[model samples]
Structure formats: C-alpha cells, structure tokens
Target: MPDQAERLRELVRHWELRRKQTRRTIAVASGKGGVGKTNLTVNLALALKEEGRSVTLLDADLGLANVDVVLGIPTTYTLAHVTRQEKNWQK
Candidate 1:
C-alpha cells in the first residue's frame, strides 16, 4: 500500500540495519528450448530493480544469446567484449 518512494525508503532502512554483504545467483536453465527462460529472467531482473536492488542479467547462452532481443535493446557489448578486454565488466 506504500508508494514507491516509501517502499524504497523501507528497503534502504532494511539494508542499513542488516549491513551485511549479501549476494545471490539465479540461473534459468532447462534441457529444452523455447521454454521462456529468457522471459522469466528478464522479468525477475525488472522486479528486483523495482525493489531497489542492483540486478545484472547475464545471458550465457553462447549458442543463441537473445536476452537483448527479448529486452528489445541493441547489443553494444557482450561477454566476448569483456573477455577480449575491449570492455570492462563495470560498463
């Protein structure tokens, strides 16, 4: 029932109280294709971001990496770019 700003403040307070380094890794994988893994991952990232948590979505499907396609964003950099040292992970 709280507004966005209030909810974010609550999250900030919660994090401040905890003050512990917490990290989570979620992987969406299925033996079959066309199972909406990318869609679910993208939605989860968006929801986490809305909750004021930093989210990074990495599509490791080297065969057909299409997270950018689902997000409708042009791919300017990728894992290859990072590996090649052309781009850094912070970017």
Candidate 2:
C-alpha cells in the first residue's frame, strides 16, 4: 500500500479503538424542512460507520418516514406498524 493509504488505515484503526472504548448516543434534530437536516443525519451516520461505530437511523415520524428515502432504504415497516414492544427502534 502507498503511504497515504497506510495513514488512512492507521486513522481508521484509531477511530475503531475509540469506538470500542466509548459508546455514545446522539440525536440530530432540525426545526425546518429542506434545510439539509436529513443530509446531515446521513453524513453523520456515514462518518460514524467510517469510524467503525454502530449507527441506526430512525425516521420517528410515526406514519411517515423519509430517512430511508434519503439513505435509500426501502421501508419494510413504519412506526405505525410497530406495536408496543414489537420493534423498539433498533434499525
């Protein structure tokens, strides 16, 4: 591998170590639509994935969900369909 590739791998390894050592949950919110909120969520999830962290994107819009649309995951089930304990947002 080239020098830059080795450096990137080293950084990824470092991030993986950090991810393993610390687990944190963060909620991203926005008050306006078409304001890049979904984009931010998508990018954040991608970043965490790059860092080897487990990330789940939840639409939480009850009957409507667009995260799957932004991320392009077909909705198999919605919050409306999920019962009390059927699926606790474990995407």
User: Which sections of candidate 1 miss by over 4 Å?
Assistant: 1-16
Tens digits of lDDT, candidate 1, 1-91: 7899999999999997675457788988998999999999999999989988878899988678899999999998888888789988886
Query: Model 2 lDDT vs. the true structure?
Result: 0.76
TM-score of 2: 0.63
Please name the candidate that would achieve the greatest lDDT relative to the true structure: 1
Error of 1 at 13 (Å): 7.3
lDDT of 2 by residue, 1-91 (tens): 4799899999999998886988677787666667777778889999989977777766665644588888777777777656656765654
Could you tell me which residue pairs clash in candidate 2?
none
Q: After superposition, how far is residue 20 of candidate 1 from its true place, in Å?
A: 6.8
Model 2 lDDT at residue 84: 58
TM-score per prediction, in order, is: 0.70, 0.63
